[model samples]
Target: MKQAPFIAVEGPIGAGKTTLASMLAEELNLPIIKEIVDENPFLAKFYENMDDWSFQLEMFFLCNRYKQLEDTVTQYIDKGNPVISDYHIYKNLIFGERTLNGTKREKYRQIYHVLTDDLPKPNIILYIKANLDTLLTRIEKRGRPFEEGMDTAYLEQLIKDYDDAMASLAIQEPSTVIITIDGNAVDFVENPEHFTEIVSYIKELMK
Candidate 1:
């Protein structure tokens, strides 16, 4: 049998990465690897005050994602099981660069490179793109306590960063396929047809 492909769904916050990843995993019969956002102890504090907790929050995410990816390779990839993840490991760097500054940022990069240097890359990345109004609306609908009253300016920058990161990934990793989807075009969570359309897209990509 052919080895199963690893698929990662990525996007700015509230862009539906987790929901899409879950749907794809079920449709494809693949294991899902989700980011442990609620488990981050520093997240609430970081959101309340970014400058004070930026490094700690980013480091926590980096360590957790590293371990998750390591286990993913051992438990799924090595066994030829297709895997779908809500967030790609590189998201740590994307968020880290936005939060950390100067010497701290440089130091974090060194550690990040060392930790991720040998990890297997996802065969395909699905990037969900949305306008700021759509993102804010979705974020409001979700109603996560920590995410309540999130800074609009911060979210604007995050969207830009995600776009830049995806563009960079396209140029840097020519072997990996990256597909950008307009988040506003489909309500995959509420509408079955929308979900089916996305599933069909993934099936075609896998072929």
Candidate 2:
């Protein structure tokens, strides 16, 4: 049996991870498993008061993502076609660590480890990055009601964390191919060439 190809597109909010992942999936004829952010009831409150709701929100996401992947990953395994995802499993810990205290973070990691022990890691991780200003603009333009109060300070902190994670990806997980793209520079929606280049990269890595 052949292994199914898996690709994860990750970044801070509004970095175009979802848009790019959808485009890549369509272009490459792959199915996609998107993050379940909309189902998270605490998200709006968490954004409004990170100090109060961060841990709960993060745990919810961690458990939800794990459950979804467990149910879906086997279907794709060895099937030869790729599965494109907007967010990866690591985001649970990546974003969780930002708000969790030492003890709470440790506990979250322990649970996360056990839950994701057998899950398939991505064959390729596409990291999309844009300037903070660019992300803010995109987020505002999309106008999700929950995002109305999102502030620059929060976004800047998240961007810093994302960069740190990608910087360590090579040494941390040498088996996976990690690719960084400048989303601010790409016309993902209008330029077919840009989209094609991304799809080509994923295809090459899968091969």
Kindly list the per-residue Cα lDDT of model 1 for residues 113-190, writing each as its tens digit: 999989887889999999899999999988999999899999999999999999999998887889888898878888
Per-prediction TM-score to the true structure, in the order listed = 0.96, 0.93
Error of 1 at 82 (Å): 1.0
lDDT per residue as tens, model 2, 94-193: 7888878878889988999899877787768999888898898889988888988787887899899999888777677787788898878987777988
Query: Candidate 1: where is the Cα deviation over 4 Å?
Result: 1-3
**Pick by lDDT: which candidate is best?**
1
Q: What lDDT does model 1 reach?
A: 0.91
